[model samples]
Target: MTLVLKAMALTCLVLLLLQNAPGVGAQMYPDFKLQQPQSSVVVIKGDTLTLNCTLSGSGPVGAVKWVKGSGSDNQTVYEQKGSFPRVMRAVSAPSNDFTIRISNVSLEDAGTYYCVKFRKGIVDDVVFRKGGGTEVSVHARPSVPVVSGPSHRAVPGQSVPFTCSAKEFSPRDIKVKWLKNSTLVRAEPPHITPELSNSSYRMSSTVQVKLSEDDVRSELTCKVQHRTLAAPLRKTYALHQALRVPPSVSVVAAPSGAVEVNKTVNFTCRVQGFYPGAVTVSWLENGTVMNAGSSTQPTETSRGLFELNDTVTVQAGEEKSGSRFTCLVVHEDQEPISGTGILRVTAPALGENNEGLIGDSSDILLSSPGLWLGLLLDKALLAVILFFLFKRILP
Candidate 1:
């Protein structure tokens, strides 16, 4: 019995040695070979992707399958018995070619793919061979950027927010920038989000801008950069659309000092340094609104501000003396601003008696001072002559 046991042990050791030998193990499956021709591939999003897997020599192959990833994280891609909606065999059945085509490929499809061969076993399938992995890189171009600004219009020195956004892109790394009038502007870091359904990415960037009068013609641009883009994408927003500048108003009379009765005088209303050009100007005589006036269109200045001139003619009548002419300017739905000028009227010259009343009242008072002094001297001289005559007669 001991000798029989020894012989059995020797037989088992010899079998183990043969199994462990390299050439001997290779001889068991010398004719089996699985090949994956492609080393790597890149596919754009929403397009089709093809992975080639061909078998040259086969021995005890029971099934062929494609898998993504490795070990614990691996997931089956293509299997003979399973149904995959977006996956299909590239070639017809009854062939050694195992190439597959994936339709509507997305970022989630990007990974290492492997072609594997399984051998039928008593209870479970055994991995027979595996091909070198084919690394798949999916690339998708970002959508055109959209820019938005604050809802309410901004005045000078007011800070407002602007946002830029792009969506449905791949390869998470992206760059965004803000520019004002072709010059770079500092902004906050972009926010990136992932799409769970399509495995895509979305990004948004924001910037705060302080408005100025110079921004009337300025442009704000949002620029995006990505590896898939040949050139950076740009979207511009006109700064004038978000800016408001109140107008500076003033009223000036043509005959500044005073005018003769019945003389025609002009009062000009000047509206300057306003943005967006549109404005309403009206004149007021005393406290009542005037209907007669000529207003010019608002014209842009070299500095990008706007200016307008409105003129009204009035006769310097006796009843209209000391009347106040006011210019009321309304801009951008804001409260009206006003500037005023006073009208002074004088009677016409009527010989020497009305010579003092021909000009302004202040000027008449200044010119009559010398005449008053002369009259006082004449009276004194007459009194002195009479006194001397009386003294000689009394003596």
Candidate 2:
């Protein structure tokens, strides 16, 4: 009877202890619960972040704190003693709300966060409960794109290189493209590199273009696309900035072939297929600079090149016969290009009674031998008749 009573008392003490223990009481009451409503969150850089947490039930409770990461990599984010500068409790103390707010969040702040319940023990605080972690994903927008081209001017049929670059962006997923005059241009694949300084990424894209005369007014665009951008970013560069095409020069006379003396002649200088429309034209006579000629404004061609025409008028005089007329074209700080035309002059004919008549008779006699012999025979016959008449008259 004594052994039986001792065993029963020991079993009663064990039951009392189990009912008062925190972990056992939590399971027995079934009212203790912790909840993290958000399983994951995404926030942009420089924006505020909110981590939701709630506690309920009338079970044993203790101080609450927010912890980031897990295991050996864990770090205390917020607690009753102290917290980081950018981190704080969302609700005031003495309440069931254990939500947290982080202001001015950066890329470094991205991680999983947990709302933890801790109980004060004899030696140290012990973890009583933990809510499901909230995964934080921070995103950073890429910088504006910058476009560049070759330093020297490019000509038709030449290949030139152009570059477009962007930096300081998070997440390696990015796209870059090139365009000319709103049309897509084939280019090399984008080169992505890690920026160790800020733990971000940078990208560059290059394209090789075979130039044509039509590119003088063309525009090149660099377009960038990323997950953080609502619309693609674009930067434009004018092709004319690096294009240079020389003009083809020619000189033509109004009459074409040859012109008589004292005749009015028109000399035209044609400047075609040149870029950067600004040009000057001058005329020269026998290596001497003549008066400024009339020039038409540079006109744009179908191929986007420029053309101009300049005219100079002069009288063709006897002294100006065999004279040379030159057309000089100066375009875009380049040396002069020249084209030349020659003038031919002839004197007016004289009347029949003048020295011109005597020269014509001599030419006819020299050219017709049969006619000269007939005239000589007629003269000899007339002389013989005169001699016979003189002899008869004298006898």
Candidate 3:
């Protein structure tokens, strides 16, 4: 009987404990949820980025502490509260009042971030901001870095600042990163600029890196990253005191510069020796234009290393002599130079020549109708002379 009474008392005690556990269930740290933006978008370098996060439920923010994995305790990246930023005790009025503002974010700032709430000895509510998640990207293009000492080569321990810039983009989710031999160079503050409002910016950076022979010998790339694209943009370049880029060109042929009648003989024009490479060639027959596909290009450049190629076949008895084939090179700030070659078409057969001569002789004979009139004038003069001589002899 005593054991039954003890068991009944233990059951009542267990029910009381369950009822008092409300604090553990109510004040529990809700799974920190972030709302507002469905996707994280990235853009080219030199663009601004803003991330807006919202709460699932409505309540006072109470106290909010924002922290980043990359930012150290001393260097607080972003804050919008009073003193003691480590503990931001602000009231979040509405669900829409939750947001984080990041300006001109860079690669170093790329990491997870958090928003949490805490009360003394009590587990208060918390909100969270996850990784930047590629919200911005920098489209870094291939460029030649500003080399102070020498662009060609530099020794180790030499302080060389590789300066490059990227233009702004939409949604502004771009990142610029420096690399040496495909390895990242770590440093404090990895210098970055702030995002501007209502306008895009051109972000420039001078990476003070130690230059070794390896940096001078081969190709280097200045890479730009952004969330807009699946791959990062890269600009490839080489450092050399001497510029090694060469000029290139193509050839064109003229219409009517073929083996048919009323067409001149074919010709070619070629231009070479340029840098950073943009070259075009054209064919000119007596200063007229010709395009490609008119003639086949040689596997190797012909003499004078012309930019274009043009040739015309001769038809039977086609007059092609005295026609000119010219090649021209096109470039900025440079006059187009042309080379000319002569063409000659053989004359027609002898019968055709005789017919042409007869037609010309008929025209000449008809033109001088006065020849018959001159003969009649001479006959009249002879009759008058004979009559006068007979009268003089009879007297």
Q: Which has the greatest lDDT?
A: 1
Using TM-score as the measure, the top candidate is: 2
Q: Summarize candidate 3's per-residue lDDT along 112-226 as a digit string, tens digits.
A: 4554433332243322233332233333332222322235434344665566566543334456666656777543332345446423344555566664433434444566665
* lDDT (C-alpha, whole model) for all candidates: 0.89, 0.86, 0.47
Error of 1 at 312 (Å): 2.4
Off by over 4 Å in 1: 1-29, 37-42, 59-63, 67-85, 88-95, 118-128, 135-139, 193-198, 351-395
Which residue pairs show backbone clashes in model 2? Answer: none
In what order do the candidates fall by TM-score, top score first?
A: 2, 1, 3
Clash total of candidate 1: 0
RMSD of 2: 8.9
User: Which residues of candidate 3, in runs, are more than 4 Å off?
Assistant: 1-44, 58-61, 70-76, 82-96, 120-395
lDDT per residue for candidate 2 within 51-90, as digits (tens), equals: 9988898645568889999887899998878648988778
Ranked by TM-score, the better of candidates 1 and 3 is 1
lDDT of 1 by residue, 299-347 (tens): 9899889999999999999999999999999898899999998999998
After superposition, the stretches of candidate 2 with alpha carbons farther than 4 Å from their true spots are 1-30, 37-39, 59-63, 69-95, 101-104, 118-127, 181-184, 286-291, 317-319, 334-336, 349-395
